[model samples]
Structure formats: structure tokens, C-alpha cells
Target: MRKIFLFMAAIISAFAISAQTQTIVIQGPNGKLMADLSVPSLNTNEKKTVAILMHGFGSNRHRPLLRAIYDKLSECGIGAIRFDFDGCGDSDGEFVDMTVPKEIADAKAVYEYVRDLPWVSDIYLIGHSQGGVVASMLAGELDKDAVKGVALLAPAAVLREDAIRGNTQGAKYDPITPPEYVELPSGIKIGRDYIVTAQTLPIYDAALQYQGPVLMLHGTSDIIVPYTYSLRYNDIYQNGSLRLIKGVDHSFNGYEKEAADIVANFFINTVNDYVL
Candidate 1:
């Protein structure tokens, strides 16, 4: 009878997990984009907090690592939403013509939309790679009251700086590329019509002054963005700290299970601290 009960519990748990996640498309200030929303199965019994996941540059909402993280967060009872930034994912926009400001504007729109969801109790932002910069900007200047915390995973210290130093190998996919040879991922093509050139300094600078609790994580083995960047960001922010994961890389690469655990744990703990 005990074994039978346990088997039934497992089947119920699987159903619950599947019901909590659904693919969605939303219209932001710029245009429509693809997003994946997930929630913990147990969360339906009670109100729960939410964390929004933003993927890295040259990536989309369906990246495996991010999907895994979202799944884990859902299992832990936190609601999650991951989307492709305008012009980047299933959203409508010209990727090369986009600037940092445009992306930030889109993120702001997402924040507003998510906050209005009937099931949300609180909202948090979690970003990876370039997405970290977007989250940081939103955390500081979001026009909404629902946003409660910020989390950066290998976020770029200075987006431009990271770009200048990024592997030219990856530049090829940039809908807009630097004067170097490299392929960008996610179909970001580089061309002369680039709309987000360095003049967008206003957006980048504004991020430094963000006002909110921040949590940064980076791995030492990350060749994409240095772990030192996360440390510096943590040092500068009044309400944050950087946790270095030894031997980890930019995408958390081979550390999927561990990375998901850490990201979910951070979401839980960060929200807990803010409420008190």
C-alpha cells in the first residue's frame, strides 16, 4: 500500500508540473514577443511570488539552461517568466537596429505587464549575460511598484566593454557586428544600420545608479564574462553581494543541475530577505 501511494504521488506531481507552465506571446511597447511562463504546482494552493528570467545576448527564451532554471523555480513554488527581448526572439523588431535603450524599454513593458497578472504576489528580476544589464536597469528605474528584487547571473559589467572584449568568434550572429569577424548566435546580424551604437551611453550609465536589492553570481571559469565583473558590481551596489562559483562558466555550461538549484535558491532567499 505504501508503494502504491508513493507511485500515485509521483504521477500527480508530474501532472502538476506540466499544468504550471505554458508558452505565451506578449506585446510590449515595441512589439509582440515570445515568452514561457512557469509556476510551481503547489503554488496554486496559495499565493506565491514571481521571478522573471531574461536570457543572454544572442539567445532566445527557449535556451536549455534557462528552461531548466525556470522548471526548477516552478518546482520550488515560485512563478517564472522568460522571454526574448524585442527584435531578438519571437518578438517583432529588427534585431540589428535595436539599441540598449530599446531593450530596456521593452523590459519595462514586460515588468508592467507581469505586475498586472492576477496571480502575482511579488515580482523579482533575474538576468543572465547581457540580460543582466537589462534587469539591472529595470531594478533601478522601473516605473512599477511590483518589482521587489534583482538578480544577475554573469551579467556584463559594462555591456560595451564586454562587447569590445567578447570573442569575435561570436560576433557573426549579431544582427549588427563590430569591425571584426565573428558569428553571433540567435540570428543577431551585424550591419551598418545598427541603431544601438555607443552613443547609447545614457542607458548604460543609468544602470550604475539602479536603486534596489541586488544579487550577483558568476563562475571563475567563465570565459564569456569575467567573474571579477560580478565582484565589482556587487561591491558598487549598496544592497548586493556577489557569490563566486568556483570552476563555473558563462552559461553555467555543464553545471545545469547545480546552476538551477542555485538560481532557485537565490530567488527564494532574496524575496524572503526583502519581505522582512
Candidate 2:
């Protein structure tokens, strides 16, 4: 009985000190952006490495995918910070004001906030869908050594293609005279600046500049952003690898655990092999 009681106590103690997660607010380009920071309790005495997670268009940081990735990374002893874009979730801004450039700026702000942390030994960036584009572009713009690595999931590099056709969320308009605000099929309002900027944004060329290890994951059956987009990324990234999850959708809907595990392992392995 005493042995069994000790075993149960050990399990309970392990759970008590496994990980720590907290809600935080960071200053963004537009206003305050709500975020969650997760750190592994076991690494409290060591300088920790962190990954910043960015969400997709019309989505917030509290997304299930983001949450799953956050938990998984924390479980692997890495810190993670997932934040809302300036105009999404609990952040302060108007949804109509959202644009790729503005989101890049927002991400930069969050990056800066995390970069200066005394406990942080290395930094990595991960993004999904539109956020993946932002992550790729931002990684390219930063000093090569600034970010240890980058991971993109089903990046919407097609935004540039959509912009060239003057199509904003399935609604066509004259690129020359874009409406003040365009509503997407998801009911999110985007400004003309969003469409106009996409036409000129060089996602692929920009991503090529970041000469760091890159990992791209996409679902083979992704209808929104085809898997070919990630394939193109694999070709552009000098040190990148692409993994296709067979029969998975863009969001990896029912395969969240599998997708999260893959992503978490990629980061964990990269940190162990290179950053540490």
C-alpha cells in the first residue's frame, strides 16, 4: 500500500511541475495583443528557447491548432508564445484594417518582445495559412541568425496570385479601384490595402533570403491552399524539407494531434541538433 501511494504521489507531483502557461498582453503596432506564453517547468534553471506562433487570416491565437502546438512544444521543454494579430481575437484593432503588411508589423512587435527576454537562448517562428506567409516573409527580413529556424503549415502563398486577379475572398473587383472594404466568405472584413499589398508581396522570393532550416507541412488534399504551394517552398528554401500529410485538409481538422506532433517534433529536433 505504501509503495502504491508513493507512485501515485510521484505522478501527481510530476503533473504539478510539468509546464506553466499564462495569458499575457504585448504591445502591437495597432494596440495591445493578447497572447499565451507556455514554458516547461523542468527547464526553469536553464536558458530556454522559444518559438513564436502566428495564426491565419480571420483566425485568433486561441485556435485549436495553435493551442495544440503550444502544448506539444511546451511538453518538449521549449517555450512558446502564440499571439493574436492586431485586428483579430482579443487584440485591439478593426478587422477591416487587417493587411499582410500590418500583420507583419504586428508579428515583428511580438518578436521583439520575445527576443529581449533574458531567459530566451534562441528564437524560432511558425505560422499557419496566411500567417505562414507572414512568417516566411518576416524570417527573410530578419538577420539570418536572428531566427534559429522556421516552420510553415499550408502557407497561402497564393495570395499573390489572388491579388493579381483582383479577387478578395472569392469576390472579384477592379484592382485599380478596390473597394474600401471587402468581406470574405468567412465574414471578416478586409481593407483595400490588404488586396493591393498582396499583388506586390513577393512571398517566395522573400522566403528564399532566409538561409535557415525550414520545415513545410501541408495536407495532400488541402483544397484552400494546394499542397503544391508548400512544394514550391521546398524548392525555394535552400535548406528546407516538405512533408505532406496524406488525405489531410488545410486545417488538418480531425488530425490535429498527428499534425501537432509532427510540428512539435520538428522544432524540438531542430533545437536539439542546431540551436542548443
Backbone clashes for every candidate come to: 18, 0
lDDT of 2: 0.86
Which RMSD does model 1 reach against the true structure?
4.8
- What local distance difference test score does each model get? 0.71, 0.86
Badly placed stretches (over 4 Å) of model 2 are 1-16, 42-45
The residue-by-residue lDDT of candidate 2 on 168-218, one tens digit each, is 668777887788887777777778888888889989888898978889999
Backbone clashes counted, model 2: 0
After TM-score superposition, the amount by which residue 210's alpha carbon in candidate 1 deviates from its true location, in angstroms, is 3.9
* TM-score (all chains, Cα) for each model: 0.80, 0.91
The alpha-carbon deviation from the true structure for residue 253 of candidate 2, after best TM-score superposition, in angstroms, is 0.2
Q: Candidate 1 residues 162-273, lDDT tens each?
A: 3445433354334344543333564456433232353244434565566567778888998878887787777667778678899988888888778787777776776566
Inter-residue clash pairs, candidate 2: none
Error of 1 at 228 (Å): 1.9
